[model samples]
Target: MVEIAMRSYWNEGPTEVSLNGLCQRAGVSKPSVYREFGNEDGLTHAALENYGHCVLAKVLEILAGEDIFAGKIRKIAYLAAEDGAHESGCLFVKMRTAKNQMGEKTQILIAAMASMAVDAYANLLIEGRETGEWPGNIPVKLGAAYLHAQIGLALDQRARGEDPRVVLALALCVLGLTDAQSEIA
Candidate 1:
């Protein structure tokens, strides 16, 4: 039932997915869903958590991977632009876009997750600087925020049905990657 709800929220926006619909589709009773998840907010929170683990974790993995900073950044672009799992768009990005309509609990979770992503990116930039993969002139915090924003923008474009190749090219370009280096797609 949780998996069904997560996928529904991923493929369709959370606002578009109703608890009643989820119950019916998951072959569970409304009371069961409520009992298990507490409420719509609880259910949404659960689904987002699951998405972080299942989908967003890949980005965290890339950040933590052995690849150079540029390679890691390129991989993130490819994930946003060409990953099969994100063909329908990113669930987190969708939720983030509609965070204004989210329940308080979900909103809080979103904020925390966004901050954590920035911190992770900052750490990656610090490592990159140490390894001389990128220049040390850029402030790590600012660079991290920039990278995070770029990724979100790329994912937003992908969600809007932009051509994957175009999205990849533009994302790489913004990350200072040349055309030759943007050939990962």
Candidate 2:
């Protein structure tokens, strides 16, 4: 039921979702939902956490695979590109965008949830640098900023109905994860 509500909210955005609507979609009674989740904000908070877990799980799987740093970054870019297919963009970004609309507690929870992905990516970059897969001079802060920028670009392209893959490719090049010369060749 929580999953159903989360998916609906994710696909449609928070403004369009309602507890009654979620109950209908989940095929559960309103009383059952209230008994479990208390209110719309509560449900939304849980949904965001669930969404965050899903995103983090995918990132973990990609990082766990046997691939070079560039390859792993590319894979993560592709995943972000795919996520841009949805209206609200990445769940974490969406939650951040909607922070003002959420309660104070929810806002903090959402921020923490969003931070997890950035932290994971930063840690990956640090590990890569330690292993010589990434440049030793690469600053973790700058790498995290680059990754967040790529995500923003991907979301913008998606909002404009453009191909996010182009954004992803360009982002990789800008981050020095891909060869600019090879792109021209």
Candidate 3:
């Protein structure tokens, strides 16, 4: 049901959601859904929570991997790209664009996801700098802000059918890394 809800939101946007259609898509009865999740708002919040977990897990998994700063950034760029599966747009991006129409719970979940992304960027920069991967002079705060901003741009570009590599370059530029940094990636 969470997957069904996410797919619907990503494809149709929340403005077009219909409870009966969602119940049909999930292969669950409306009464069962209502019992489990209360209503459409509850279902939407649950889906957002699921998506937030996926996003947070991906970042945490990457941070624990052997990849360094640039490699991590590159992977992030790829992940941010809009695949054919999400033809309408990324769930988070779509939520952001249609925020005013969203229920408060859904909005809160989206904000949590964004906060998680920022924390991931901050943690990566902190560890990278300590390990001699990131340039020592740049503050972690600045790097985090820059990385988060670039990731947002990357996701937006992907949604618009542009290349993520350009976003990757902008991210690398923010780090002010050398050509040798590609070796780390």
Candidate 4:
């Protein structure tokens, strides 16, 4: 029920949703909703945490696949670019924006979620370097920062109504993941 309410609020903005509306959509009583989540803010925070975990799980799954780091990162980039136009560019991104307006507890959760994402990218870069898929000279931390920056840029482009694909391509080029042979596709 909390998840449903959160998804509802995420899809449609907080101002557009009401407790009664969530109860109806979630098929739960008002008291039940209140019992689980004291207020709308509570529901929103829980939802953000749930959504953040979901995104992190998906990223981890992709990274855990059989492909090399470059291939996995490419696939992740494509997926992110494809979904860039909605909800302020991603649920995690939306949560980050919302963190500023949320209570300190919620802000901590959001920061932790963001840290997980950055750490995942850093680990992937380290693996890539170890496997000779990426240049060893490039520090994993720097690579992670670069990848995070690209995500922010992609989200910003989506917010500005710019072409995410073009921006994604440029980002790939900047990351040294693009070459003439790969471009043939």
Candidate 5:
């Protein structure tokens, strides 16, 4: 049931999916879902947590890797471009986009996830500077914020059906990722 709800909420916008629809798709009763999740907010929050563990964990792992900063950025851009089987968009991105309509639990989770992502990005930038893998012209804090926004923008573009290669090229260019477009292409 949680998997069904996560997939539905990931492919379809969170605001667009209904609890009853989830229950039907998951072959479960409404009361069962409510009993398990408490309410729609609880269900959504749980789904988000699941997504964080299943999908976002890999991204965080990449950020925490020994790879150079540019490599990490390119990998993330490719991930966003591919977006695996869920072609609609990122669940996190979708949830963040519809944050205003979400319940308090979901909203809080979204904000926390956003902050975590930014912090991860910041840490990566700091490491990049320390290792001399990326130039430090931009302040680490500012660069982290910019990279986070750029990644979100890339995911948003993918959701809008933009060409994946074009998205990849643009992201690499914007990040100044040293001839990565040609190599990645």
Candidate 6:
């Protein structure tokens, strides 16, 4: 039920959400929803938490893996190429893009999620630099920001109904990775 509401937020954005809609979609009673999550804010908060752990666990693993940015980017691009994965949407992108419309707690959670992702991305950039896989001329922070921005753009395009393959290819080009180098696909 929480996840259903979360997906509603991701797929439909803030304008289309309602407790009634969530209950109907989730097949749970209104009272049950309130009992479980306290209120809409609580429900959305729980939803984001559920999404971050359950739906995003595998993605988080890949982010924390030994692979460099190119490999990671290519792998995500391939996932985007897949039909189901492309349609599921990205939580960070959705939440970050919609933070201003969310409640205070939900907004805070989005900040935490975004900050954690940036930290992880920066760490990966540092590791890639150490291995000569990431760009040496750019500072690690800048490289991390660039990579993060590229991914955010790719996901945004994916959300906007662009061909996931093309969106990813554009991002890879921005990151300076050739198809030959991105064998993770």
Q: Is candidate 2 or candidate 6 better by TM-score?
A: 6
lDDT of 5 by residue, 1-185 (tens): 88888999888778888898998998899999889989889999999999999988988999999888778877877787785753676889889988999999999999999999999988987887788766667777777778777677767777788766665666455555557666655
Model 2's alpha-carbon lDDT is 0.69
Residue pairs that clash (backbone atoms under 3 angstroms), model 4: none
**3 or 6, greater by TM-score:** 6
Q: lDDT tens digits, residues 1-185, model 1? A: 87888899888878899989998999889998789888889999999999999888889999999988778877777787788888878888888889999999999999988998999889887887788765656677886777777678767777778765665565445545454245754
Task: Judge candidate 3 against the unseen true structure and give its global Cα lDDT, from 0 to 1.
Answer: 0.71
lDDT of 3 at 139: 80
User: In candidate 6, residue 126 scores what lDDT?
Assistant: 72
Model 4 CA lDDT for position 8: 70
Off by over 4 Å in 1: 164-181
Question: What are the root-mean-square deviations of the candidates from the true structure over C-alphas?
Answer: 2.1, 3.3, 3.2, 3.5, 2.0, 2.8
> What's the residue-level lDDT of 101 in candidate 2?
88
In terms of lDDT, the poorest run of 10 residues in model 5 is 169-178
Query: Please, what are the lDDT tens digits per residue for candidate 4 over residues 9-66?
Result: 5666444577789889988888876687786667767877777666557777887778
lDDT for each residue of candidate 2 in 88-162, tens digit (9 for 90 to 100): 466556567778988666788877765765677787778777777666455786777677667666765665567
TM-score of each: 0.89, 0.79, 0.79, 0.77, 0.89, 0.82
* Highest-scoring model, lDDT: 5
User: lDDT of model 6 at residue 113?
Assistant: 78
Task: Name the candidate, 1 or 5, with the larger lDDT value.
Answer: 5
Which 10-residue span in candidate 2 carries the lowest summed lDDT?
A: 176-185
lDDT of each: 0.80, 0.69, 0.71, 0.67, 0.81, 0.69
Clashing pairs in 5: none
The TM-score obtained by model 3 is 0.79
Error of 2 at 131 (Å): 4.0
Model 6 Cα lDDT, one tens digit per residue, 84-169: 75474676677777778778888898888777767776787677667767555666676567666666766677777765555555
